[model samples]
Target: MKKEKGLQKATDFSGIKTIDDLHQHLKTNPDDADELGEHFITKLNNAYAEKNKTESDYEDLLVALDEWEEKPEAASKIRNTTYEANYLIIGACIHNHIVNNICFPGVTAIQRETGLSRTTIYRHLKLDDFRPYDKLIRGKHELMAKRALEHLYYIGVVDRNAGALKTFIELTGFSKKSSASNINNYIQINNLKITREELDQLPKEITEQIAELISEGLQAKDCDKKMEDMTT
Candidate 1:
């Protein structure tokens, strides 16, 4: 994870009023300001990375801070104290990370982790400025698809006779039409030696059934067993 070059140089912080304001103040005014600034920036960058936030999100936060400056009430609420400011910044970073990057199976998982009521989470999500859940879910699916495709490629390279699509379906336990679409897209995009004909040869009914088992929360092994039973 490379640090953004823009953040390396100290930015004007007189107007911005957030936990980051204190961070910038300390970095530029202290006797060992250079060292302290570097240290603080490193920790801040690490927090962003830990939350799986991209550089774009960091830029968004900066913009949000700028917007906050215009709202005196919000600006006044920002913590100036070092310890409290650090804590709040870290918390917000984690929350942002989860909202933008994590794909929770349900609201309960989110509630357990954030200690926020499901209603509050939903309300925040409804705000246009908040992270887009749909995009996050799509991103998660794309990642899973990529990994599955890579595995298929490896198996194909190692053993030409291996049933890569069937193996991938079994391994990922992804039976949905979307999952199938992702796999097909990856196959086409990479122009991998594997053929659509090969994938199409697998029984569509079994694939769809596997997806149904997945939606029912069946484990991969159980789904495999169900698939086997269906075939035999």
Candidate 2:
């Protein structure tokens, strides 16, 4: 407790590296065991805390790497921590949802799959620029309707491959020559052409994941019923 009274060298020294190092220090210093026990415990606790952070960070990094391999275009995001990786994965989920569906999957759906906090997911969504699917804005913003145009392209209505479409007014109700030109710009910028699929359909992996979530929910319900019976 009295830091100033202790040996200056001992106090100034770097942290105890390992259990063996602590034992060596105790042997050479001949400190009181009861007094030194708390110090060693603190050091060990610090080591454990660092281990948890580094371990989780490595795991998140691996997941991020896998995602980057699949969608190499997103590798430009420059992330270096578990926190950043969480954002990256959430962004991927949002992008995938846009590619696969009419609207972004809600935060809870993303949470069920990613196990990230709602706040983290929401923060990533806030930085989203590709579309308004993840946003709360009610109406279509004409100049910024990239996702809508891409959806049309996928469905063969606004054919990017043929360089064809109905007028922007007939297709989207709001006429903008800029929207059509922007679609071409988007195709050039992202170098992507989404395969056509029914809007109601989900990818095979997502379908399996939904089934697993349902099974887990049913198991949790059974556990709750048993707990209620025990209380009664």
Candidate 3:
């Protein structure tokens, strides 16, 4: 029970938008690094999954913005603060750019693409820690579980829509199939080595799932452990 409280406390990375914020946090509670990093990974993963949801790039962001203006309370897709929304949106841009593009686009390009000023992009992205920069006020874990489904598409185990399914799984625990049984039924498995930088092309949540699956069939190295080892 006490652990849950500490965890809940640790999850609050609201103000941590910059690497300097992370540095200050480390100075005070150096021990929380692992937990902090885990939260960071979770945040990025959530944002990435959010990025994947829309078939098109920043178009949905504009739609979400319109919804917010009409009814802030009903803007389920947008974040609370302007900064928070920008952060998530920028994270979406970053996640989208890095994975989808062969060449990395500069912040200036990101500004043009998302209609966000370069300053806004810099602020939320200055992260050097695990503090979550949330865009969605609710449904974090359910969102993250969806990332695991992306592996199905990556590995050719399922169609592209597979990644959209994890919202139904409880992050607390789910009685899904074994890691191996989940993917062996398919052909042309994408190499899911956790150590490969390509794995970073996927969100940490999906990477972790891939690691678990690959670990069983082949003597895959403890790459997934490395991926989950947020302390470092």
lDDT for model 3? 0.49
- Residue pairs in candidate 1 whose N, alpha carbon or C atoms collide under 3 angstroms: 175-211
Question: Per-residue lDDT tens digits of candidate 2, residues 1-232?
Answer: 7656755553522444444554565566654344444443454344334432222322333334334345433323322233355555676877887788868789887876566655556555675532323222322344357677756545433222222233322344323333444343221116654222321155656534533454456567768999999999
Residue pairs of candidate 2 with colliding backbone atoms: none
Off-target runs (Cα >4 Å) in candidate 1 are: 1-113, 117-120, 123-141, 165-232
Query: What lDDT, from 0 to 1, does candidate 2 have?
Result: 0.46
Cα TM-score per model: 0.26, 0.22, 0.26
lDDT of 1 by residue, 1-232 (tens): 9975664564443353344754466455545344433444454466444643332323334334434345543322321222233334434745676788784335555445444434444444454533332344346668987887887745643444235545555455333343454544323325455344555566877545543543344345657998999999
Alpha-carbon runs more than 4 Å astray in model 3:
1-79, 95-101, 128-139, 142-232
Using alpha carbons, what is the TM-score of model 1? 0.26
Candidate 3 residue-wise lDDT at 161: 30
